[model samples]
Target: MEFLNDYLMIIIWAVVLVGTILIEFETSDLVTIWFSVGAIGALIAAASNVNFFGQIAIFIVVSLVLLALTRPLTKRFMDKEVIKTNADRTVGMHGVVVTEIPFDGKGEVKVDSQIWRAFTTQKDPIPVGTRVVILDIVGNKLLVDVLKEDL
Candidate 1:
C-alpha cells in the first residue's frame, strides 16, 4: 500500500500507455497511437516526480503536438486510390441487346463477350440486336440507353 501510494501516477500512466497501444492495434487507423505517445510523456513526468496535474498537462501537450505535426504525413501514406471492378468498367460502354427488352422490364445485353441483365427508361420496347449504351448498374442489372447511329 505504501509502495502504491508512492508510485500511483507511474502505474496509472503505464496502464494508460498499454491501453492506448491495445486500442491502436485494434483499429490500426492512427487514432490512439498519439495517446500512447502522450502516455509515454506522462510516464516520464511521473518518474521525474511531477505532480499529477503537471503530468496530465504534459500528456495533453505531447499528444496535441504529435497529432498536429504528423497527421498530414500519416494521411498521405494512408490515403489509397480506389480500384475499379469489371462491373464498374462497363459504365458508358456500348453493348448489344441479345433479347427483346419489354417496356419497363428487364432483358439481356451483350458487352465485351459478357451477357448482363439490362433495363432502359425508354417508353417502347427495345428490339433484339439493337445497339445500346450502358449508363449505369443497379444491383446486378445494367441501366442502358439506345445507342444512336451517329456517335
Candidate 2:
C-alpha cells in the first residue's frame, strides 16, 4: 500500500501518456497531439521527482502552449477548401446549348443567368436546346459534354 502510494504519480503519468497517444492515433485530427506531448512532459517531471501538483501544472501549461502554437497551423493546411474561379464554378453544371456547336467549332451555352462560349465533345453538331454539362474551362471557352438523363 505504501509502495503504491509513493508511485502513484508515475502510474498516473503513464496512464495519461498512453491514453492521450491512443486517442491521438484514433482521431488523427490533431485534437489530442498537444496533450500527448504534455503527458510526456509530465511523465518526465514525475520521473525526476516532481510533486503531483507541479507535474499537473507543467502538463497543463505545456499542452495549452502547444495547442495554441500548432492548432491553427494544422487546421490551415488541413481544412483548406479548393479555390474556385468564376469559370471554374461552372464545372459539372448543366447548361443548354443556345447556338449550334459543331465539332471543331464554337457556340454559346446558357447556364443559369450566364451565357458562355462553349464547345462539345461530340463530333456531331449539338443543336440549340440540347442539354450539356460543363467539363472544363479553356481560356474564353467552355468544354462540354451531353448530359444523360440518369446522370
Candidate 3:
C-alpha cells in the first residue's frame, strides 16, 4: 500500500512534466510555469515519503504560489520583445512578388532581403514582378494584397 502511494506520486510528477512539455510545444504559451512547480513538488513529496493526499495538497499549493509569483515576471519577459523574429517584424512591410501567386494557393515574395511564401488576398491571380503589400502574417506564410497599379 505504501509503495503504491509512492509510485502514484511519482507517476503524477511524471505526468505533470509531460503535460508541461506538451503544452509548451503546442501553443508556445506561458502556461506551463505552474505545471513545472507542481511536478517539482510531487517529486519532492515522493522522495520524502509523503502521503498521497499530502502530496496532492502540496503540489496544488506550490503550483499556485509559484504561478502567482512568476506570472508578472513571465509577462514582463514575454512582453519585452515586441517582435522576436524577422517574420514577425515584417508583417506590414511591402514586398515584390518573385513568383506568380495563384488565388487558389501559395506563392513567393521577396521582402526585406528575404524570400518568403506568400498568399494573395484577392480572388484573381497576381503575376510575378508585381508589387504587393503584406497585410498580415498567417503562420509562416504572408497574407498579401497586390498594389492597385499592378492590377
Candidate 4:
C-alpha cells in the first residue's frame, strides 16, 4: 500500500510537469509558474518518501511563494517589452494622399503599399497625388507635412 501511494505521487508529479509544459505552449498568460513549483515539490516528496499530506502542503506553500515572487518580476519584464500597434514605425517614410485632405481635418495616405490614416501638420489642405513625409504618429493617425518637391 505505501509503495503504491509513492508511485501514485510520482505519477501525479509527472502529469503536472507535462500539463504545465502543455499549458505554457498554449498560452502566455503566466499561469504555469505555480504548476512548475507544484511539480518540483511533488518530485522532491516522491524521492524522499514523504507522506501524501506533507507533499500536498509543501506543494501549496512552494507554489504560493513562487507565484508571488514571479508575478511581479514577469509583469515588469512584460511591461518593459510592450508591443506598439501604431504608425510610429512608419515615421520618416514617404506616401501619397489617396483622398483630398480637408483644410481643417484628417485624410488618408498610402505608404508601404498600404493605406493608412493620416493628417497634415501644416494648415493647408494637401491635394491628392501630392507626396507627404510622415512627421509623427498620433494615436492611430499619422501626422504629415507636405514634401516640397511634390508641391
Superposition error at 79 for model 4 (Å): 3.1
User: How would you encode candidate 1's per-residue C-alpha lDDT over 105-150 as one tens digit per residue?
Assistant: 9999999999999999988888999999999998899999899882
Comparing 2 with 4 on lDDT, the higher-scoring candidate is: 2
TM-score of 2: 0.51
Provide the lDDT at 60 for model 3.
Answer: 88
lDDT of 4 by residue, 36-139 (tens): 77788877888799988888888889888888888898877756464676456789999999987776788899999999888875768898888999998887
The models' CA-based lDDT, in order, is 0.91, 0.87, 0.84, 0.83
Q: In angstroms, how far off is 38's CA in candidate 3?
A: 2.3
Clashing pairs in 3: none
What global local distance difference test value does model 4 have? 0.83
| lDDT for 45 (candidate 1) | 91
Please list all clashing residue pairs in model 1, or write none if there are none: none
Point to the candidate with the largest TM-score. Answer: 3
| Local accuracy of candidate 2 as per-residue lDDT tens digits, 60-138 | 9999999999988999877857677777888999999999999989999999879999987788888899899999998
Counting clashing residue pairs in each candidate, in order, gives 0, 0, 0, 0
**Pairs that clash in candidate 2:** none
Q: Which parts of model 2 have CA positions greater than 4 angstroms off? A: 1-3, 80-151
Which of candidates 1 and 3 is the stronger one according to lDDT? 1
Task: Determine the C-alpha RMSD for candidate 3 after optimal superposition of all C-alphas.
Answer: 4.7
